[model samples]
Target chain A: MNGVRKAQTSPARSRFRDEDLPGYLFMAPWILGFLLFTLGPTLASLGLAFTKFDLLSPPQWIGVDNFTFMFTQDQRFWNALRVTFVYLLLEVPLKLAFALAIAMAMDKGIRGGDLYRALFYVPSLLGGSVAIAVLWRQLFQGDGVVNQVLLWLFGVQGPSWISNPETSLYTLVILAVWQFGSPMIIFLAGLRQIPAELYEAASIDGATRWKQFWRITLPLLAPVLFFNIVFQTIEAFKAFTPAFIISGGTGGPVDSTLFYTLYLYQEAFAHFRMGYASALAWVLLVIIGVCTTLSFLASKYWVFYEDER
Target chain B: MSAEAGPGQVGSEPTIVGVIARHVLLIAGSVLMLYPLLWMLASSFKPEAGIFSNLSLIPPSLNPKNYIDGWNALEVSFSRFYWNSFLIAILVVIGNVMSCSLTAYAFARLRFRGRNILFALMMMTLMLPYHVTLIPQYVLFLNIGWIDTILPLVVPKFLAVDAFFIFLMVQFFRGLPRELDEAAKIDGCGPWRIYWMIILPLSKPVLATAAIFSFLWTWNDFFGPLIYLNDISRYTVPLALRAFVDSTGTSAWGQLFAMSTLAIAPIFLFFLLFQRLIIRGVAMSGLKG
Candidate 1:
């Protein structure tokens, strides 16, 4: 398919030399933006990592010092990293499982499925949002509605979920899990793509519903599952707004909710440690890159893309 | 892998029981999901003490002053914040539609030296968390004196800097039939003309998709406003909402809830307006496109 299209375009390429120019012209704004916004800052940050470049002052070059501080001296960086990893580990698998289960159930042609899907998706739209996070702060506060409900139901006392270190992070984790909408929508789309004939054939062989799911549905949905997993995992790591907003940008309660990105934000902006923050950013980039590469490698064993080489 | 009860055996168990169980789960789940919003609405009408005292979904008395106080006490003009968010969202939609679709068309159709490499780079940008570049970008904006303005927030989107949107457009562009481009070319058209005359017209579904996403992301982008805009008067809705979160005075649960509800209402309305298209776009973008 690629060869045919290339040949067709190649022969008449000269007739459409103007075509390429227009495409580039249309793309000029983006090219300019890529250079200024993304590339410029990205490179500057790398350079700044080896130096102290507070906003108010000129950068002072101190090679490898910031790196040494982060790795060997900064316990907070490691703490943030550990907090982020735990958040990622718990959030990703639970979200994927819940999303998939909900999608599968909705795909069963139940009544009012669209409404159910919409309800399921609303939290996702609101999940990372400040307003929702603020609302979450209220709902989980010491005298907030959640604890009040617990009081009414079990007559058992509950800690302030968003104020206490032990439960504050869990509130954010639950919020992360609630935004299972996007993945659920994707899974529904994937489930619908499977040939109905496969399910029919399985049923003809007297296969149970559970067996059919394992043999047919699960295999067919693996590619979509892979996409959801990678995106969600990265997103979980990148989660900041909830922690930032709910904890009032302190990630407080003893910094229990101090996610890596939040800590990076604090370092860069709050402390004006531009050099250190840059190193932290690069480290995060490397971690994400390594994680994604590993996921891609692992996918070869499980994810079955259609029309693969 | 069949369980103790197979399909036929499962059918022997009362079908009514299974159906009832499904209904119970769905209803219970729905209630759990909607409870927070329900409580928020109820609490907004309640008196300040009632907010913490009563856990009822129904408040005893409605204190309409929450809405009034929230509107009156806002440091930045609430109407202005709305306008700012609206202006930013509209510009983002316009920028994304033009730039994203054009770049996507290039990646999907046109061949150029380093095309594959550039496309791969674009995908690589997707994996780089925004925090990595966020501070540096803020510093650059500060240097250029674009801080305290919406330019830093709105302008970068025009450059296809948002890899997710670019990738989304690329997938949609690839899905279009090559025959459309062929026919357009045969009609004395070049790539730009084809994009204008053929591709843009057929791209409504995806364009709407991009529009809805750009709108939502820009509207909810608190970090951008938080980092760049120091002037409270220049605040967007999200930043404006933060005013209710006080360290000195009492936390205005009533007013905060009221403003949050007001802030959330329009976006919810937008979602409802574009529900089908947005859902279709999401499904397509994630599933195959």
Candidate 2:
């Protein structure tokens, strides 16, 4: 078999010497696209971060002034950051835990699992759209279904979830948690990879189900959990559409739902502060990078792979 | 795939009470999850005053006026938005399939200097948020006079700018046996022939996944069209839906709900028809990552 493979590839190697051109040609679209769209814009945004460009006027170099303004002067910048962090804190853990629990429940081999999985996944499929965001606004309105249900069932008046300043951000968080299908699906896939014999061995060894989960499931599923955490955190940070639609694109109710991206978008488009927005965008990139790196470093302690073992 | 394992072991059947309890919990969760969507659908059929006043899923009367008003509520009809979304989604699906599969073929089956570095760069692009690239991309499109056109939204897709699809296709391509390519090469099949004839034909599942995801994402995309297309005439469904609600909250809520329901109907239908492929695609992405 090895000799046959060697014999096959030797002539192909000679032919492939000239075939690099086709290979490169095939890759040209992505290469050109990356250079023009991603790389070029990344560098341009970096340069623009230090300049004042509002699309009409030529970009004026202002050297670190944008950063200084963000650091020292902009209260809304701080508010956006605080709101985003609160959102991240509330969203990432709750969504992941909820997804993991549901995935574990599903892992017990429920009848018609596919139907349940598909139904559960519907929200995520519609989660990012403007239509769903509008629906969320209606659902949380003062006289909407949520409040109506509260009044009917508990005889308590429900606050306008999206309109109330104190509760508006939580409404977005709840929305984030409600669309837990993606991570739940991921966790389910991960659960399938855990060998069944491990559970059998644990059970034979007199391990309780709860103990088996702690000993077998969580440890083996750590890498998947870590992945989900990192992904969901980044996603939570970048959430825009829900907040945009809910707050009428203003990040309002006194900036209660002013997500970092929404604020950046308002600065860039609504106010035409492209330079300031560029600065905000760079800061967001750094924050995400730092969070990702920290997670990677943290994963060293807990995230185990079968190959690594 | 292993045979289905019970919560404990193979021989032990779960208690009927336990099974019933699981179903009960699942049913409750499903209702909670599905309530918003059902409420929206119900509200679409309700009268304007009945929308906020009555919380019943059963409208007092099955009024279809909301649908009629919503269809023509804005300056442009909902058909224009739906047509625009479909046109963009179809083009995006084509672009992603054509460009990403080619790129994935090159990365998977071919070798060149800087191949690893380029692949790494492509993977790195996955982590870079679109917001970081939004301003400069907007500026570039503006400079090229592609603003207010679908070109900005549709063109980058042809270039395989979305690295997620490229990565997905690469994973699929790499899983194919190398012997097939070798056999094709011995048969005097060129790279193009091997890719188009051999690889593409063999990759229906991944291709279907890619096409479905690209269509769904493009159909639901709000930001790209929001930033690029300025005219209401050129607006996609998401933008058109946003136009239903004015800032003052005095806008037509019933019409908005009606149009919103109609907007998501295609996605809901698509999800139902292609649920298996979609779930598998999502699972493949998550597990591979």
Candidate 3:
């Protein structure tokens, strides 16, 4: 298909002896951006990871010291890693499951599905803002609506989820899970793409609905499900704002909510430890890369594409 | 492998009781989702004493003082923050649309050396975490004295840094038939003329999608402004809202909630106006992602 299109465009392309000039011209801004913003910065950060530079002075060569300290000395680094991973494990699965359940429900041709969808999706739209973070902080406060409702309904007193070190990270996880609307939409789209005839045939063959689900739905939606896993995993790792907002930029309550990126921010911006921050950033890249790689490898066992047949 | 045949059809319990149960689940889920936001919206109008005292969404009596006070409560005021945010968002939208469309047109239509390889590299960057690129980019901007200004936030958009939009536009441009380009070329329309007169005119939906998304993301952005801008006066809405949190004690929850309500009002308006477009954009982008 691509080869045919390329051959067809060759005559039009050869109209100018400088055929690639137009393409090159169009790509000029991106190429410049690639150099100044992406490639240059990426390489420079990698180099800076090896040196001890503050913004105030030239970087001093520090071979493996930063890594040594991070691995051996930094308790907060481990805490950040633990906090981020815990958030990821809880948030991603719960979000995906909730989204999938809702997506499945929406697919049933319920009354006013669009209105229901609109209602469900508003949180994902507004979830990223500081406003929502502030609202979350308020809601999870000791005297906030959550506790109020718990007392009113269950007659049980609730702890201040946002401030208590035991439960602070869980509040952020809950916040992340609430914004399942995007994945829900994706799952809905994937569900819609499945031909209706298959279900019709399955039902005609005396296959029970439960059997149909376990035997059909889960595997067919695997690609979309896998995409959501990878996408939301990356997002959860990069999550900083809510933690920042709720913890008041301190990642406080004894660093229970110290997100990896927030810690990196404190290192780079707060402390001006440029070299250390660069090392931290490189470590983040590796973590994300590892997560992505692991997902893809696991996907080989379950994820199926249409063309594979 | 038989799971590939039929994806979930809501597990189709078509009985009346089943339908009612599903509706109950959905409505309950949506209410659970929207309660916090609606509660915040309702609480924004309440006085400080009434905010937490009443678990109900309704205020005892409507009050606009929170809105009034919150607007001026911050050192720089919410109005200035709104203006700053709008300025940055508008510039970002224009820059992203222009640069991403240009880059996308090149990839979608024109045949060039290393085009395939370059396209692959661009796609790979879609997954490349911004953290890796952030530190050096920050240092670069600091060295160029772009820090504490909107330049660090606004300048990158103009350079087509958003590769996802480029991928999106490429998908769109590929869907346009080659017949029009052929006719334009037959009339001696060169690549530029063909791109401008033929392709772009037929490409409104993709362009609109890109624009709306660019506008929305820039408007809601927190990290970029948090890192780059220093002064409260230059702060965007998100930063300003954070400042309200920092400056005020518990006496000001009313004012904080009020400004927070106002901060998300524009986004809520945008969602109301362009809900379908925005949802479709999310699905489209998610597929690409």
Winner by lDDT between candidate 2 and candidate 1: 2
Residues B1-289 of candidate 1 have per-residue lDDT tens digits of 2242222123233355555555567678878888888888888898877788876689777768888888767655688888888998899899888888888888888866556787777877777777668767887778889988989988888888887888987887788999988887667676778888888898888888888888888888888888887787788888888766753134678888888888888779878998888788778767763
Give the residue spans of candidate 1 off by over 4 A: A1-18, B1-14, B60-63, B247-250
Q: What fraction of the correct interface contacts does each predicted structure contain? A: 0.47, 0.66, 0.70
The reply for model 3, stretches above 4 Å from the true place, is A1-18, B1-13
Candidate scoring better on DockQ of 2 and 3: 2
Clash number for each model? 1, 0, 1
Residue-wise C-alpha lDDT for candidate 1, range A49-118, written one tens digit per residue:
8898887888899999998988998989998998899889989999999888878666754668898888
Cα lDDT tens digits for candidate 3, A1-309: 343346467845544334477878999999999888998999999989989988888889998899999999999899999999999999999999999988988784667988988899999997678988999898999998899999999999999998899999999999999999999999988887877677777877878767877777888888899999999999998998999999999998999999999999999999999999999999999989998999899899999888796
TM-score of every model? 0.93, 0.96, 0.95
Candidates 1 and 3 compared by lDDT, better number:
3
lDDT, candidate 2, B1-289, per-residue tens: 1222334333356666666666777788888899788888888898788787676677777789999988998889988999999999999999999999999999998876678899999999999999888999999999999999999989999999989989998999999999999899778787899999999999999999999999998989998899999999999999988888763264578888888999999999999889989999888878859
Q: For residue A213, what is the lDDT in candidate 2?
A: 76
Candidate 3: residue pairs that collide: A216-B3
- Measured against the true two-chain complex, the DockQ scores of the candidates, in the order shown, are 0.49, 0.58, 0.57
Interface RMSD of the candidates, in order: 3.5, 2.8, 3.3
Residue range A20-100, candidate 2, lDDT tens digits: 678799999999999999999999999999999989999999999999999999999999999999999999999999998
Model 2 ranges with Cα > 4 A deviation: A1-16, B1-11, B247-251
Top-lDDT candidate index: 2
